[model samples]
Target: MTEIHVRDLRTADPADAAAYAAVRRASVPAMPATAESVAYTCVHAHPDARYRALVAEADGEVVGTAQVGLAHDSPEPGQGYLNVYVHPERTGLGAGSLLVRTAEEFLTHEGATALYTWVLDTPRNRAFAARRGYRASRTAQFLRLDLARAALPPLADPPPGVELRTAADFRDDPRPLFALDAETAADEPSDVPAEFDDYAYWLTETWRHPLLNHELTTVAVVDGEPAAFTLAHTDGDGRYASGMTGTARAHRGRGLAKLAKNASLHRAREAGCTEAFTGNDTENGPMVAINRWFGYEVFDTEVRHVRAVG
Candidate 1:
């Protein structure tokens, strides 16, 4: 008999976070994760989002996990997410299904009307989601750059009215950056739209995240206001990622977003980051072109899947 059972993740237990991180890293190396970051997210998620983390145990050994939450910031209500990952070597034991089943039960009780998730772009993975009644939607690509070996373009002088600054320069106030983020996020491609409206929540859940490398996060300023930015995150092991890079609608055509990202990437490389990673929606041609120009190559693709919940 299979001994697989799913239960709530014990955020206070060090082993839980480690096991969760292990499963994620083993299942999708292209996705970035750390034990501390996982725990921090569990502890800091906004209450209205109804965030819940679940772990599947096979005879007392952790084998899979699911992070379920509602898209509280989305203008359209009743949208939720359930991202499940099982240890690469521990699949085929029903852990993944069990995690999904348990997560859906909870989300349904929360009044979620629709569910969305990401499945790695592999034959088996895609088929699994299809069989579960989840239809494929938009696709996204994960790109990687050998920061230590690639030749980055020379830094270009900003336009007369634009200036480049690191995130740390806005220590006294980050509201302007928040506005820029919200504006750009509204244009991102996704099955469920996301909005950034809660300033306090954003400060705790994002700005202060342990992995957020403020010194390496570059911002483009126009007339003393944030116009574009590249938020940087590093795991302190020489691996860095551009968590988000966006240009406000008002600053879209001047290449300020590219300038901000380039500045951040240069700083990350100098800080011993041997590799850098970022992702973009397949429909986002402009950003995709920018990353390609940055010497990044698409290494992995993930397909979004959606299902209606009762």
Candidate 2:
């Protein structure tokens, strides 16, 4: 076997995008990934985020990939993230270690003071992280629901003064969604805190994402205002994923979020989507319970790890 080398992704190279996507898809089957998504991410990365995508190659083949970047919007400064994934069939060939080492060197030189990553909770993966001086922080679970087989909550009419709409209805103006997403994202649990204060950034990075299905993303409006929403993404295939679901602070405890998610899921099922996926921080009891009510089952677990840098 040839030695593995980690290098920056070459977006100009067509094969690079596919290779990167292949590694990521093989490593995390539940996550949405595609060659187009990979290229879009590399080209439209937030300038303030200081993002970089790297691929590990061995024998002229891509075997691993990593996304390293600074969390510029984080209220805390010097926060960086390095989420690396090696092809399952190629593990133990040094691709993971090489990618992590290269990622650390790059981010640290970029002035990052703390680094964070999510490692699968398997014994081997956890050991690899610990050996690299990373300390476990929090856990999250990836849940999957067979849209074709699993029983979902019946769709019900919205309460008085409440109405349901799809994200497509706001194509002319998405600032209301920017406001709702920003507020809800802040309360989410994470190792590298995120703050979505820039609407323009959200537009370029999120609103225009190719995977986003505005026609299927459900929103619940109350009293003529956006109250809760469930953003949805599909791979144009039979697989669906919930990008996010949150209720405005003023509308919490009224089941608006669940209502929006249910509407979105029903739409996905009607559209022939066979599987649906979502992830939640283990500590988020409310959201976890809500997903359970929708019949999502925990399929995998990952623990966040942190390594302090200069």
Candidate 3:
């Protein structure tokens, strides 16, 4: 008889990180992840988050993983999230169920009143979430672009008084970029309201993230002030992902965000990245249209599901 159980992932173990990353990559190819990034997340999560990387083992082999945590940045209390993925080859072995059960128990104990997760938009996945009593919410799409061959839009010169630079240019002081990011994040559509006032947390979690590629991240500066920016993440392989693209509220209608993204994508292709990926909420029509114009296609979709923890 096969036995399956879930436990907190050993963050410092390289092998554990590798196994967790392997399962995630095999389960969702569109989502780019690496051992280094996984380990970083496991170790660097905020204390308020009560974060846990849970792994499911079947006969002592890791085959499923989940990221469970409280939404520390949310304005509301008792909001939590848990995303689970199992190795495609190891499905039907009860690994996923064990992981979910373990994660829910942890979140409930952590004072979570609501639990949210993303389920791949498929019949089986949808049915599984439904059985778990999670009601469907918003939908998000994973978009991909052939960065190696697709004809990316030509990089255009910045308008007068506007200059283009990489994130590395702001290495001395990234506070401006942080402010812009906070504004954009606040404007983003989400079920849970996010507040980004903690600069220390932002520096630790976002700016210093392992996957961030400062050289490929483009920023638009207007008259020496940061206006818009596009963050880039790469796995040292050919895969590149747009982490975020946002224009300051004052800088809207100037095409600054689009300009920054185009510049970043061009730099990514030139840097030998073969594939580019990004995600957008279905409600974000403007961003979806921008990505569509960049030759990205919807490769997969995931529906956000939520349930109240009794």
Candidate 4:
């Protein structure tokens, strides 16, 4: 007989965080996971975020986990998300179901009217979400590039008054980056619209994120103004990911986004990152083209599943 139990994350226990990270890495190899990242998220969630990290244990070992929370940054109210991952080795133990149930109930109680999740495009994963009342919405592709072999675009010399810099250069004052992020994020294509008007929240959640690579994050500066940037994150294991890349509205159409990303990728490769990963909405043609130009190949895809709840 198989038994399963779901419980909240014990941030105080490093072992618990490590176990959660292990399960996540085993379940979703495309995503970067680390014990420090798990602990940082648990410890620094915004006061109003109402976040929960639940782990499902079967036969005395954690076999599944979920990160459930409201989309507090979205302009639309009552939007929530629940992403569940089950260890590939422990699938038949009922841990996945238990984790999903627990996560749904938590979101429902928090007044979420809609819940969105990303299910890997695999048949089994799609079926699991469908059976749970989620209808597929849109698909996104995950692309990976072998940094060691991929030839990155040459770094162009910044125009006379323009300069290239890393995120660390702004360590003493990151408000400029935060402002640029807010502007760009507000216009990103997504089912749930976000409004990043809260600087303090972004400071705590994004700027201080554990995996963010400040030195590898390339920023484009024009006349000392941050115009474009590519945020980089690393897992300390040779894997690097492009967390976000965007250019200010006025700076768009000038290849600034591409420039920043190329610079960041080159820096990551030089820093010994062997693999690079990034995701783009299927409809985001420009970004998809940019990644393709960088020699990234589509490796996996996930479809967003959404369900309505009272």
Candidate 5:
């Protein structure tokens, strides 16, 4: 008889982190994840998040992983999330179902009233979520740019009074960037509303993440003040991804965000990165247009699904 079981990931074990990252990479290529990044989250995640990394094993071979957590940063209480992915070749082994059951029980015990997850936009994936009582919500498009070959737009001088800078320039202090990030993130469309009030948490969770490539992360300055920025992540294997790109409310419509991202892409290519990846909500038309203009092509889509927890 084949047996499938789920258990807490042994975060201290580098082998466990590698297995978790491998499953995630096979299941969702657009989302950049590495063993180092996985281990970092397991160690540095906010205490309030009640985060737990889980793995499913079939006859003692790891075949699936799930990231389960409460949306502790969200203004709304009881918002929980769990994303489960089974190795594509091992799907019929019942690992995915076992992981979901285990994750749901854990979240429900933590007082979650609404649970959300992302399901790949495929017939089988959508049906899997639907059968599990998840109702689809919003969709996001994964885009890719051939940074090594595509003709990136020529670098142009920043408009008068505007200067281009890198995230590394703020090594002495990053509070200003935090404030701008908080402002722009607040305006992002989401089912769970998040408030970035904890600077210490941001520093621990985001600013210090291992995948963050500070030298390539570009920021735009208007009149000596930070206006827009693009956070960059690189996996050291010629792969680069844009973690987040945003502009302060007061600086919108000035193309500052695009200017920063373009500059960052150029820097990433110059730094020996070959493939660039980014994602945008389908509802975010302005940013979608901007990404398209930079030659990013939509490669995949994911649907956000939510279910009420008792």
Candidate 6:
């Protein structure tokens, strides 16, 4: 007989958290992961955000984990997410089911009316989600660039009266970047629309994230105003990720978005990062063209799944 336990991650030991991160990295290589990042998520989540990390242990060994949370920042309420991952070596011990059940109970109690999850584009993963009542939705692609070998776009000088800066420059006051983020996020394509007008939440969850590399996050400034930015993340081990790159609506046609991203990637390569990763919705044609211009190739895809719960 197998006995499984699901518990909050804040109470888990550091080794267990590390194991959880390892399983996630192995299961989804396109997504960035690290023990530090996991711990940061646990510690830095907003107080009002109902975030929980549940680990499944079979008798004496940890074998699975799930990240459950409410979409507190979305314009619509009662949106929640629960993503479950079981260790590849220990798949048949009922850990996944136990974790999913516990997560669903928590979300339901919190008044969640709908839940969204991203499942890898594989038959087994799709089948698993389908068995639990999740229906397929739009998909996104994860792209990677071999920075060590691929030729980057030639660096061009900033247009007259435009300047380039790193996110570190805004450490004292990130409100400008926050405004830009809020505007860009509102325009992003998603099943659940987000309204990132909250500055405190962005500071706690995004600006202070462990993997965020502020020094390499390039920003484009036109006439002393933030026009575009490319948020960068690095694992300090040759892997760099484009966390987000967006341009203010009024500044869309000026090529500032590409300028910011290219500047960030050059800086990342200079800092010893050899690989770059980014994700885009399949319908985001503009970003797809921009990434292709930067030599990024599609490596993997994951479909978003949604389930309605009354």
The top-ranked prediction according to lDDT is 5
CA lDDT of every candidate: 0.90, 0.91, 0.92, 0.89, 0.92, 0.88
How many clashing residue pairs are found in candidate 3?
A: 0
Which residue pairs overlap in candidate 2's backbone? Answer: none
Give each model's clash number: 0, 0, 0, 0, 0, 0
RMSD of each: 1.2, 1.0, 0.9, 1.1, 0.8, 1.5
What are the per-residue Cα lDDT tens digits for candidate 5 across 1-310?
7799899888788998889989998898877888899999989989999999999999988899999999998988999999999999999888999899999999999999999999899999999999999999999999999899999999999999999999899989999989988998898888888899999999988899999999999999988789999999998888899998999988899999999999999989999999999999999888899999999999899999999988
Query: What is the TM-score of candidate 3?
Result: 0.98
Q: Which ranking of candidates, highest lDDT first?
A: 5, 3, 2, 1, 4, 6
Error of 6 at 196 (Å): 1.3
Candidate 5: minimum summed lDDT over ten consecutive residues — where? Answer: 25-34
lDDT tens digits, residue span 55-157, model 4: 9988778788899999888778899899998888888788888888899999999999999998889999999999999999999998999999997888787
Better-scoring candidate (lDDT), 4 or 6: 4
How does candidate 2 fare on TM-score? 0.98
Instruction: Name the 10 consecutive residues with the lowest summed lDDT in model 3.
Output: 24-33
Off by over 4 Å in 1: none
lDDT of 2 by residue, 1-310 (tens): 5788888899888789988988987898788887888889989998877899999999889999999999888999889899999999999899999999998998899899999999988999999999999999999999999999988888899999999999999999999999999999998987667888889889988899988999999899988789999999898779899999998999999999999999899889999999999999999988999999998999889999999987
Candidate 4 CA-lDDT value: 0.89
**True-structure lDDT of candidate 5:** 0.92
TM-score of every candidate relative to the true structure: 0.97, 0.98, 0.98, 0.97, 0.98, 0.95
Error of 4 at 127 (Å): 1.0
